[model samples]
Target: MKKPLQKSKIPSNKVFVIKELREAYLDKYWHSHEEYQLNVILKGRGTRYIGDHMKPFKEGDLVLTGPNLPHVWRCDNAYFDPESRLETHDIVIYFPESFLGKDSLQKDEFEEIRKLLARADRGLEIKGHTNKVVIKMMKELVHRQGGASIIGLLEILNVLAHSTELEPITQIDYKNNYTAHEKDKISEILEYVLHNFKNKITLKEVAELANMSESAFSRYFKARVNKSFSDFLGDVRISNARKLLQDEDLNISQVCYESGFPTISNFNKQFKDRIGKTPMAYKKDVIDSL
Candidate 1:
């Protein structure tokens, strides 16, 4: 398979960039770049995949991802319709490690920022008041010039570096072996699984898709995510099933099959194991909330 690495360049006249993306939907390609990115979703909802983690995302979501950690945000199906009026808007900041200066991070005052960058290797979801403050700074930087922009960016980073409202997105031990070929392989597997998760998928099928032997794929996935492929699929299915259960029309049995489980018994067991409630009970809770 061809490498889908994203080769993004920053202008020599600029130390970093802050911009807004307004599109029919966010970019769906699973690609990586050479700069750390801070993103705030102004509008839209979708699924986000970063390194070894996959989760739902929505409006106002804020994330910081380290350089070259493969990631993508796949918008909901509604956004893809030409007849639909849906559009996504995002505010983003991109900077390389040397944005401030080549040796800037080595200074005593930059220790916290350096640590923040280290945490960013796993991708971070900024939360609470901190999320609001950083976003405000990002918006301010959009209209700032010269040193003002630099100070604005630094203020945002300083707030991030000192805040406790950051949630790491990937597993604690998630490795960053993001070689070009590895990015392509993982991106392919993610695409296949996400698009086909509602149907039966087999180890051999995904193995062939990645052009690796079944055993090799098994070992590779386990080493990276610390979980077997089947377990990962189960997590994905359960997550989707939770969403489906919110619909009053779909019963537990229907949700089970629609979420790719072969039998309701297995579905119930897995649901309770991961979600801490039986399918019926979970459905009842959703009903009660409404």
Candidate 2:
């Protein structure tokens, strides 16, 4: 059940590399690598999975991932529509922890950058105006080469180091051991839950999928995923409900039932608890932003 280990094909001569991805969607399976990653989504909205965290990601979403941290951005169903002509696009920058040399991060001049990189061990999301600045720098670097490209990366890291508009994306104590079998097992569970979350699910049912008794499955899942199965299912349902809420076609009750909550009252309670806003209010805010 282990997920694949994606060996990043960085050029041997380059200290860091940047690439632009334009496709129907990103790779499907969960994977990890040995390089730090800075990802900026230019055109896409979907579920983003990092470590044991899963949430929605849209355009302007900027995230920095520490080396060997597993991550993926799965595009929404609309993007795969034959008639929609939608495409997924993003800018990705990859560099090793010591890209600047073995002793560079230990130098006084790199103190801030070193700290920033260290915090990325839990993953970091660049936000607010800082996201804007870093995106611009990334764009510039995409078109530059040689010494200029390296300098651009330095500038981008410096800006990130000084920016306070950053949020940690993973748990404080999360560690990546890269257990392939367990990773694949969790990946399978995630895929099944995401696709079937709208239907009735029970602990016994999923336990069978993992080939364990309900009690054993519960402990195994909680230990590896850092959350109970019920909580994880609720999160998946709520995340999808948020997306459906933004659509003009669905009303509150429709979204509530469609998102797998058996009753509107239950959906309202869960929505408020998870999103910090009532469904209608959340919809209004998204519309206002538009």
Candidate 3:
């Protein structure tokens, strides 16, 4: 078996593969392959990267990604601390988009599932009752054999196809500009942002990092990411702000400042614009859920 960090190649003879992983960190490099993927973080906290989207991920987060949508679940910095003892558990299922046979999904019985596959092109985060049920089924699936495994997969897919709880993680038209060198360049940019997003970031800085003129880099980034540099930065900042607000010690103003926003007014506006709620309301919702 290849080291887990390498881009995985699903064996051709298999219809799909399921893995229950317990590790210190996920794949360190960003890459993609031909198989569609459903990944659940059973016990972990990290920043998740999928195409142009970047957000924090934690336990119970379930995401379904279409084939060739570049992604990675990068563990928090503490996971790398030599004295820290932390691990991540993940349940991952990989199957070809046409694994059931090309004609199988063409039938009336599979119509919804076919559409679900199409929506997965931008990646979907499974949530609500659908997430609850499917995660249970997936847990049981890891121990099943042969036909049972296939049935379990179909059960999960059926729930996903019918559920309205699927949250698309990226812009509808986002597409990867896949090439080995380009892959590395994008990965470098993402990693840089992951570490530095708590501070102000500039397009000129990133353009320099990518070794391109600012105009050329702006066009290049917008082409692939389907958003301007500022919008993407806002998404990252708000995501972190929301996460930080979960702590009672961090008031809204503190969260705003700590998450890289210079003012509470701007933070409130961006938070509402991107997350559809004020930071206080969002924190309330999180509390109410508990």
Candidate 4:
């Protein structure tokens, strides 16, 4: 059994964190904050974990995460290059639901934004034209200070409200149990899994990470995440495999191995079962569309 990582806390009043990542490392433990989050990737590529969903992400990716949704951005190895000092800049916006005013949604002017936020419970991706608009707004947010930041945030939300290209990231219920201790435990478990997913992960290993026995860990995990451990791991693997498949340079066999599946047959079966398409077919579709 491995030990769990510590949880990181964000201040409630802060709207965002704009940071530069200079290395390819796991940034934080799997944890959730009270405020809704919007993350815009300025540079670099990596995997992103939101709730039960795990997928590869790259430059120009803009994601809106609902409150208390556990997530992490796994940066690509190129970020660690010594000569490339671009810092892998990421602009993140965080705000409470009340920032828009409790009655904002009741008013006709904000009803659309309110509805959009509701749909963001599963996480949302702003792509194409919408992503461009949001990225511009995020840049503005970084420069604004004082009350202007609040106004900028409202405007960003307004733009998102009108955009029709926002895509939901996952279908899993985003309602997380609200408790400090529970969030801490969940964060620890997630961090452990992300660090060790490439290798064999067992119930006992995760159970120990959560400081519980196998049986207890199973019950607690199910209760907190609404899915079993194995299912979650499979989802992570498939998501990674999808990303690998997009790279035509990698053959199907290479993708299966890199994604942590031990066999091609098993990878194909799980990929089709979860994604509704065979791995080769999925790869072909992505290539053909591009």
TM-score of each: 0.87, 0.92, 0.88, 0.82
For residues 94-175, write the lDDT of model 1, one tens digit per residue.
Answer: 9999998899998999999999998999999999999888888887788998998899989999999999999999888777
Please report the candidate that would top TM-score against the real structure. 2
lDDT of 3: 0.84
List the lowest-lDDT window of 10 residues for candidate 1. Answer: 1-10
Error of 4 at 206 (Å): 1.9
Give a tens-digit lDDT track for model 2, residues 16-96: 989999988766567777899999999988788898788888899899999878877877767767788888889999999
User: How many backbone clashes can be found in candidate 1?
Assistant: 0
Candidate 2: misplaced stretches above 4 Å?
1-3, 80-84
Q: Compared with the true structure, what per-residue lDDT tens digits does model 3 show for residues 53-80?
A: 8888889999999988888888776787
Could you tell which candidate, 3 or 4, scores higher by TM-score?
3
What is the clash count of model 3? Answer: 0
The weakest ten consecutive residues by lDDT in model 2 span 1-10
Q: Measured by TM-score, how close is model 1 to the native structure?
A: 0.87
For every candidate, C-alpha RMSD to the true structure in Å: 2.7, 2.0, 2.9, 3.8
Pairs that collide, model 4 = 15-94
Off by over 4 Å in 3: 1-6
lDDT of 4 by residue, 55-89 (tens): 78877889998876777786644455566554566
RMSD after Cα superposition, model 1 = 2.7
